[model samples]
Target chain A: MASALRVLGVDPGLTRCGVGVIDVAPNRAASLVHVGVVRSSPDLPIERRLKAIAEGIRAVLDEHRPHVVAVERVFAQNNRHSVMGTAQASGIALLLAAEHGVPAHTHTPSEVKAAISGYGSADKRQVQTMVARVLRLDALPQPADAADALALALCHAWRSGGTATGGGAVTSLTPAQRAWADAEKLARR
Target chain B: MASALRVLGVDPGLTRCGVGVIDVAPNRAASLVHVGVVRSSPDLPIERRLKAIAEGIRAVLDEHRPHVVAVERVFAQNNRHSVMGTAQASGIALLLAAEHGVPAHTHTPSEVKAAISGYGSADKRQVQTMVARVLRLDALPQPADAADALALALCHAWRSGGTATGGGAVTSLTPAQRAWADAEKLARR
Candidate 1:
């Protein structure tokens, strides 16, 4: 039997960085390993704030030692004020993943939503609900960022075919094609 | 006489990251210590590209041991395709500064131009010419990125009053006021 694949997901932000780790079995069963947010005050200097974020993420990476990392893909078309910070935070996450010898991948918000809820346009509440159901958690993940992180982790697992099935074939699909494929996967299950 | 203040300047970009080191005496006279660009091919994975940038900057920091770091502040309003990479690269520079126990500051393009040429609207050629003149270099700094990096270092020195006159007061001036003040400084010299 193939072993479970562990994934670390990051929804990067300067003020509130959300991170989650989960294990996905070959049969597609998912279980949470850890979930939390790293917060830095807006009042701190930019360097100091980024340092705090680096330390927080480092601690998580050291403890979890996940097989792969999944980060939310930020776009320039997003909120102009926060986009720069978001991109910076994501960079730190990606750099840390490389330093730890873990391969990192970025999934767009729509890809995450589609992977978790079978709909790219799903709302936050819907995505949260789906994450809870998928993980068999007693409650919905609080703070949309954390849920987003978990959703990202799940998206990576499912999109990569849970590693158990040798997920390489899934990487070639277009975004639209991937989304529908994910939706169909959910229907079959 | 106060000791010369050393600054490491970075014009952050994924493809061609510019780095320069300069020594500024209290009298606001600037001398170039080193200048170069770190290139990363876009064909590589994003993580590999970032790692190459990080190693390049880290090597420069280790070699020069500058007193401070200055990076060009990226804006979301800039070229959309490249702004994200620029911000990410800047993030690595700033984070490395913090890790190395050096202070880091960011200046916009206009700020660098005004500090170098006493005009916020100065073109690249004008700013490059001024930098070459100030540094008493035999020739122009090749590659616009390298020139921009040297300009940023000089800007940091001048804007911070070059550490000889105690630059705390300059931080309070508006952009227009600072540009005019810089112009006056050049006129008097």
Candidate 2:
């Protein structure tokens, strides 16, 4: 059996950067490894804020040693004030991935939502709930950023088909996911 | 008079990041120490592209030991596709500055233009021409990006008042700058 595939996900932002790591088994059950947010005070200069984010990401990459890293793609149409900071933070993540010799992928919000909740337009709460169920967590992750990051990781694992490993206890899909799968099957027919 | 201020300026882009270093005398005469662009193939992945830019900026920072790093402040209204790359590239420059313990500043396009050409609405050619004239270069710096980088450095030096050196041979302003200065003086009345 192949070993579980470990993935690191980043939800980039200037004031709050969320990061999470997970291991996915071949049967598609995902287990959480670590999750948290790295924050920098808004009062700091742009360089200092970015420096803090960079240090936080570097620490995670060094400790987790994930095989792959996934980051949320910042869209141009987003809030003008925040988008630049988001893009900057995302850039730091991608660069750190390269520096650490890890492959990196970026997913848009819609893509992550669809992957986790089986609906492209799924709201944030729905996506977070799905993530909690998939990982068998007792409760949903706090702060939308943290949940979004885990969803990004899970999205990458599922989208990058056949990448998960063979070893690990396989957990059945949640009823909501089963319903979505059945609905998709019916639509295909 | 204060010692000459060495400033490194970055006009950030994903494919072609422009970098320039200059020394500004207290008399406000600026000399170009270095100017060049760091190019990364668009064919490379985003991570690799950002990595290339980071390495290029790091090399300049280490070699030049500039007192301050100046980057072009990217606006949200620019071409959508290029703005993200520009912001990301700008992020790398700022992060490098923090890592190296150098002060970093960002100047808007108009700010740099006004400082270099005495007009906020100066076009690319006018700014480039003025950069060459200010540095006593026989030829205009090729590629708008390189010239823009130098202009940013000069702008930072001039705007940061009373920061240039006391010992360098003083050079008088050109007729064009003199005209603008005299015009401004008359307007104040």
Candidate 3:
């Protein structure tokens, strides 16, 4: 049987970046490995804050060593002040993923919400409840961002077919899925 | 006298990033060291393109070892299609600078135009012409982005007191300037 796939998810931000790690078994069961936020003081210079975020990501990567990374994609329609910082933080995440030879994927907020809660427009509370239930945790993860990060990881795992059916075996991948896997392998190399 | 300071300027973009390096003497005289563009195919995935940019900036930093790095600050009002990519590329530049122990500064477009052409709203052609004249180049640099990058470096140098009077020494810095300098030193340490 193929071993479980480990994934790291990042919710990029300048002041409070969220990171989550999970392992998805071939049978589609997911177990949370870790979750937390990397905070930077707003009073510091922008570059320093960026550095802090990068360092935090580096530490997480070192500790978790996930096979793949999923980051939230920033869109222009987001808050102006947040859009830029989010983009910058996302860049750092992607760059570090490339440097560490880990394949990185981006998931939109709606996509993550849909994957977790079965609704594209699921609110934060709904999403949080779903994530906690899916992971079978006793309590919801604190700091809404961390829950969102976990949802992103789960979304990628399910969308990529890391989950199996009732038969509990891997199914054949679609051509597009095969291509993405090939690209991920190439990127790692 | 303090030795001439080398500066690397970046005009951040995912498709066509511009890089320029120059040496500014204590008396403010500037000489061009290098100029080039980092191009990424639009057909590639966004992460691959961003990786290409980060690699390009890394190569420049390795070759130039500039005392400082200057990047054009990206604003939200820029072309919607380009703004996120620009911010991402800018983040890479700043991260690389911090990694290499080089101070990085951001200059707004208007500041670069004013420093080179004596008008904040100067058109591109005017800024290019002034940049060529200031650097005593035989002809204007090809690709307007490269010219803007050179202008950004020159602006940082001139404004930071790289050029001085007969005393040929730095003048008293403003409180903001002092704070920036302190941050740079701390980042290097």
Best-performing candidate as measured by TM-score: 1
Q: Each model's DockQ?
A: 0.71, 0.72, 0.51
Kindly give the stretch of ten consecutive residues in candidate 3 chain B with the minimal lDDT sum.
B162-171
Candidate 2 residue pairs in clash (backbone atoms < 3 Å):
B3-B165, B4-B165, B26-B165
Pairwise DockQ winner, candidates 1 and 2: 2
lDDT (0 to 1) per candidate: 0.84, 0.83, 0.79
> What proportion of the real contacts between chains A and B does each prediction keep?
0.67, 0.81, 0.57
Q: What are the runs in model 3 whose C-alpha is more than 4 Å off?
A: A163-189, B163-189
Whichever of 1 and 3 has more DockQ, that candidate is 1
Writing each residue's lDDT as its tens digit, candidate 1 over B14-78 gives: 99999999998766667889999998999977777888899999999999999999999988888
How does model 2 score on DockQ? 0.72
Best by DockQ: 2
What is the C-alpha lDDT profile of model 2 across A1-189, one tens digit per residue? 247778899999999999999987755567899999999999998999999999999999999898889999987778668889999999999999999988888989988887778878999998888788777788999888999999999888777752632122333864335435633443343
| lDDT (Cα, tens digit) per residue for candidate 3, span A23-142 | 887655778999999988998767778899999999999998988889999887676677788899999998888778888888899888777766678799987876777777879898
lDDT of 2 by residue, B1-189 (tens): 247789999999998888999987655566889999988999998999999999999999989899889899987778667899999999999999999998788989988877777878989998888788777788999787898899888877776642422122333864335434633443343
Interface root-mean-square deviation of model 2 in angstroms is 0.8
- Model 3 RMSD vs true structure: 8.7
TM-score of each: 0.90, 0.87, 0.84
lDDT rank order: 1, 2, 3
